[model samples]
Target chain A: MNDNPFSLWVYLSQSPLLWLTVTLVTYAATDAVSLKTRRHPLANPVLHSLWIIGLFLLLTNTSYTTYFAGAQFVHFLLGPATVALAVPLYENRTRVAAAVLPMLVALAVGSLTAIVSVVLLARAFGLPREIILSLAPKSVTAGVAMGVSESLHADPSLTAVSVILTGIMGAIIVTPLMNFAGITDFRGRGFAAGIAAHGIGTARAFQVDEVAGVFAGIAMSLNALVTSLLVPLAVTYLLR
Target chain B: MLEQIARVLLWLSLGEIAAKSGLWPLPAPVTGLILLYAELAIRGRLPDDLGILADRLLQFLGMLFVPAGVGVIAYLDVFKTEATPILAAVIGGTAITLFVTMVVVNRLGRTIAISREPGSERVEGAARDVNA
Candidate 1:
């Protein structure tokens, strides 16, 4: 069996099924820990999944391309999942509409704050222009953030990485931060998460409360639009 | 279930076309979200299956980004070269953004409530009761 051409390791390595299974299993395992811990912020499944899978790949010497070949199926679902945001939005359309004024005010101020703060902080820390450009859209979802990064002539992959890091950070901290601040409003909490952390933050909000999840979904979508426009302008005016 | 999946895919496809048209800079998924929302609004009701589907899939929304996130390993060099500024900007900037946005929105919530009808006080009460 060790010398056989059709050995299990050889076959598994060649097919997309292996990495796909690994991705699902890793997420399920980490998520179980998250649940058992009563959904503690420190038990963030995404953060856990990243390191676990990342280490597994490093150990096996598997290239990311090979891994993504199997994992793309899960990644593709992000599109449909995004579309499905409409359901929660529609379900709470009355509340969303009722809070439109605050949402609008929060959206503009929050969106600008997200961009300006990142750029200024990065510049203050002496990051290069290209890196600063990439960091500008780090708060938006990966897809939109990558697009904005490319448009700004920065590294899209770096933007994707920062976007995920931002998401993980946002997911982990939002709960304790909000609770400590005595924020009892799900709408505000979720909206802030969506703006600062994107989908992962929205996921965290959903785990906490349905109302927060819905509002987070709205904020994530809206911020994608607002951030795309603001990033370029901020890049220009601030960079100059 | 199949119908719900098709409904989502249909909107997503339309969103792709809209995005490719370059009339808007929005991502296809964001466009898809808007299109689906408009559809639900026009229909004036959500399909039960779709709601169930959204809830199920979205519950694992964090998982979906793991693959691309793992791709970050390839660019670990960037982080290694500029760990301080990068970490500071991503961590510090996100924290500030979250704190500012949350505080501002929460404070504005009161002003917004006062601006509404007398009956709208219940909205404020409901928000307070949500995680209280």
Candidate 2:
């Protein structure tokens, strides 16, 4: 009769299921709290879950590689989720079409501003060139941002980290910041979040409102396309 | 539910094909989204099952990013080294971009609303009659 707590932990750590279960359970618990709190910025499920899971790993002395081995399943779902964004865009087609020109102009300006500002700021901060280049596509989705970083000879891992941070920060601050600025239009809110934060921001937008979600999805995808094309050009001519 | 998932996967597969073939520089999911939207636009209506499935998936969209977000733990060393500058650039840059984008889009949206008000009012009135 081995009643040792550490024995159970050892057994669980060897199995891939532990991380999978941990990730889902942690997220579910935090998500419930988020909903109960009306999705307060401080109660953000992603941030909360990340902290919880990271702490768990640290406590267990589990390496990220091993944890990701099982947790990758949840990460894999991001692709299908991104595809599902089309449903809302289609559902709101009429409204989207009505604001097409404004969305386009905003997209162009927003994407350029995100890239230029990050690059300049990183340079001004005396960061390395690779870091600056990595920060250039910080507002795009992780996949696209990593690609842009690789092309620019920057660290993809750093880009991924920056991209996630940008999303989380944008999600947390965009609403309150916009409220402070007296901006209340769902489209404007969504567009700003999507263009500045990418997928994470889009996720936050969806949490706020369906209309905001749809526009955020649109802005997320559009920023991905625009940033990928523009960053390389900017890196070559502007950064050089 | 299975059928709806299959349909969604089918669109996602097409997107992957476009991405792998270099026909689209955008990610597979983004292309998938565009493909799905195009199909729905052509069909002129969303099937109920797919609609339900999409809603369910989108509802938990934030959860999907948690795994990657947790990767922050691995980079704690990087943060420890250059935390100040990185935080400053990321936070400051994002705030600026958010502010500028919101203002531009909000102004643009207002302009569009005013310019199209007359035509849109008629369209809305006709839509109301249809609903009635």
Per-candidate total of colliding backbone pairs: 0, 0
lDDT of 1 by residue, A1-240 (tens): 577765877779779999999999999999999988888899999999999999999988889999999999999999999999889889887777778888888899999999999999999999989899998999999888998999888999889889999999999999878878887777889999999999999999888778789989999999999999889888899999
Docking class of 2: acceptable
Reference-based lDDT, each prediction: 0.88, 0.85
Model 1 residue B128 CA deviation in Å: 9.2
Indicate the residue-level lDDT of B7 in model 1: 89
Across residues A34-105, which tens digit of lDDT does each residue of candidate 2 receive?
888777887778888888999988988998888888889988888888888888898877778878988999
TM-scores vs. true structure, each candidate: 0.94, 0.93
Those runs of model 2 whose alpha carbons end farther than 4 Å from true positions after fitting are A1-7, B114-132
> Best-fitting candidate, measured by lDDT?
1
Worst 10 contiguous positions by lDDT, candidate 1 chain A:
A1-10
